[model samples]
Structure formats: C-alpha cells, structure tokens
Target: MTSTPPTRRREWLAPAGLIALSLVPVLSGAARLTQLSTGATITADNARFFDSPVPIVVHIVGSSVFLVLGALQFAPSLRRRRWHRIAGRVVAPAGLLAALSALWMTIFYEMPASVTGPGLSALRIVLATVMAGAIVAAFLAIRRGDVRTHSAWMTRAYAIGLGAGTQVLTFVPYTLAFGAPGPVLHTVLMAAGWGINLLVAEIVIRRRARAMSARRGRPAPASVVSAPLS
Candidate 1:
C-alpha cells in the first residue's frame, strides 16, 4: 500500500497525541470509580474521596468524557464537519461538570495536609474556576457567532482540563528522580504541569490566528493573538 501524504499524516497527529495524553488520567479515573464502587479498602491517599464520593465521582466521569470528546475536536477533519457543532453541545456541559466538580472537591474535600497545602489548594481552586469560566465564555461566544473567540476560550478550557494528564507525565520522572515529592515540591510540580499546558495552548492559539490571517493576506490582529488568556 502507498504511504499517506506527510501533510495529511501531520493533521491527524495532533488529535492522536491529545487522545494518548488523556488516556492515563481517564483510565486512572475509571479505576478509582471501580475501586470506590467495589468498596476497596480505604487508604490515606483515598480516604477523602471515600468519605465524600459524589464530587470525586462526578469529577472523574465528567473530566474523562470531556477530555476524550474534546480531543476529537482538535482534528481538522472533524472541525470541518457538522458533528463538530453537535459535539460542542455535549462538550460544553461535560466540561462545565468537570470544572465545577473539581472546584467543589478542591473547596470541600478534606484532603490530607501532606497531600494538599494552602498553596496547592488555592491553585486548584483558581484553575478550576478559570476552566469553568472559560467554558461559559466559549458558549457565550458561540451564541454571539464569534467563532474565533469561542475556539480560543475552548482551547484554554481544554488545556486546563488536560492538566491531569500532564501532571502524570511530570510526576513520573520526578518521583523516579527525587523519590516522591514533598508538599512544596508537589505544589510546584502541579503548577508546572498546568502552566506548561496553558503555555502550549497559547502558542497554538496564536499560531492559528496567524495562519487565519495569512490565509486572508493580513496580519493577525492583537485581539485575536492575545484574547485567549485575556
């Protein structure tokens, strides 16, 4: 058989990579739900979730759905189709559930002092709020027929939601090298994970804006370039 064209191959690569990145956390979340449902023995690490299972359950399921479906949206093939709009209807609510549940857990779940200190807790709350707000802003933008603004907001929301996957990637090598991080290190690494994802999101947003401008034979306007985070 003949090989696929390089351009076509590259187009699919991004969505494929996004799906791969999402697998670990999504699988882990499923396992957690399984454990909770099966009444697995509670440990220090899992006691908080066990005590108040609803929020964690909602978070795991919602985020899992959001990540997988959201990944498909990144595919240029899907973006050009009608299903992108249909999927957005589901994706928006799923994303809101994920972000709002996370905010609830961060604020109400009594996590162990060793696991979450003030700084990490604050970081989580802020990010969850931002994620939820981004989703809402994207929905509103779409309602107003602002496609670029909608895409930018949704991209930022997806980046934040994908932070869980990035955290796993960041923590694996770190735990191996440092033998399990302390609270301070844990917070720092968590910040780094989310920060890295957001930074990448910004770059993608800017590049897309530039590409659209190039197609129109004009410079990317400042609003399009910087509106994602702002």
Candidate 2:
C-alpha cells in the first residue's frame, strides 16, 4: 500500500485544524437556530436572541458559510485550482454578512445586563465592526491585484470571525476550574479569545510573507502589518 508523503500531508494540516475549530461555533449556532425556529423555551440568556431573530439568523448562517468555506482556502493544493476563486466569491460576501450582522446584534440586541454587560457589548461592537472592515479591505486588495495584502486582510478577518470558537476554548478551561465567571472575568476571557486568534493570525501572515520573499531570493518584508479587529 502507498502512503501520503509527509510534506503533502503537512500542507492540509492548517485547513483541517481551522475547520475543526470552526465546527464548535458552527454546531452551537445550529443549535441556537434550531431553538429559535422551534420556539424553544425563552430564558433570560436566549430571550434577546428570540426577540431579535433576523440578525442572529443572518450572523449564524453567514458565519457558518464563511468559516467552513474559508477554511478550504488555506489549503495550498485547493487554492491552486479555480475552486479558490469561486469559493472566494461566496466566502467574501458571507464573511461580510456575518460581520455586519454581528455588528447589528451588538448594537441593537437588548440582553440582560448580567449576561452582556456594557463592557462586553462595547467590545463586541468594536470587534464586529473591525471584522466587517477587514473583509472590505480584503476585497479591495484583491480587486487591485494585491494578493499578499488580500491574503493578510482575509486572514485577519477570519481570525476575528472565528473568535466565538476560540471563546469556547477559553471558557472551557476556566469554567472547568472555577464556576461561571462574573462580568469582569467574562469580558477578560472574551478578550483573551480574540487576542489569541489575532496573535496566531499575525504569526501566520508574517511567516507566509517571509516564505514568499525567500522564494524570490529577497529579504522578508518589514512588519508594518495593520492591527487586527477582534
């Protein structure tokens, strides 16, 4: 029997990992949508979502498409084909939809203060806006034929969009160790989730830049990368 080459196998690892992480939020979003559609029991936590269903529906569906399809874009082999361009057409709009809907929810949703304190709401508004802006920047870059800039911006947007998945990771360990976090701790944990994703995205962007530069026998570009949104 033949086996896949290690180098070939390694190329798929990143996208696979991203898809795995994305599944957490995707599944949770699915459950939320199901609850909304089925008219599940209204609780303090979910009442806001039920009342304002449009934004949440848009956000969930859009993010699901963006995350799943966007992951495939990271696969080098897949990107080498026409599939990448076709997928990007859908992925870009989906990402914008997700980000903009999130911004709407953050601004308009009336959640219990205990669940979503002012600080957390403010953070969401800022991050959601940033995510939307990043997607726009990515689209503009690609239109100008600046592939590197487009990739970097898309990476930043994807990182911010996936913050909810990262939050599950952040909250799981803390919740397991201690009971449910209070407002301050909850805000800190949420920030940590976005912070971690952005830091990793920056590292990936710089590494890719260096690799591309090296391929052309040039020094790596200076790191004047723009800041992450979420």
Best by TM-score: 1
Q: Write the per-residue lDDT of candidate 1 for residues 1-230, one digit (tens) a residue.
A: 99988887889888889899999889999899999999999988899988999998888888988999999999887898999999998899999999999999888877886777449988998899999999998999889997777888999999999998998888899999878888888898888889999999999998888888888899876765687453
Q: Count the backbone clashes (under 3 Å) in each candidate.
A: 0, 0
Candidate 2: tens digits of C-alpha lDDT, residues 1-230: 99999988999999999999999999999999999989999998899887779999999999999999999899988878999999999999999999999888877887676666438888888888888888898898889988888888899999999998999999999999998988899889999999999999998888888788778998764532544443
lDDT of 2 at 107: 78
The best candidate by lDDT is 1
TM-score of 2: 0.94
Candidate 1 regions exceeding 4 Å error are: 1-3, 228-230
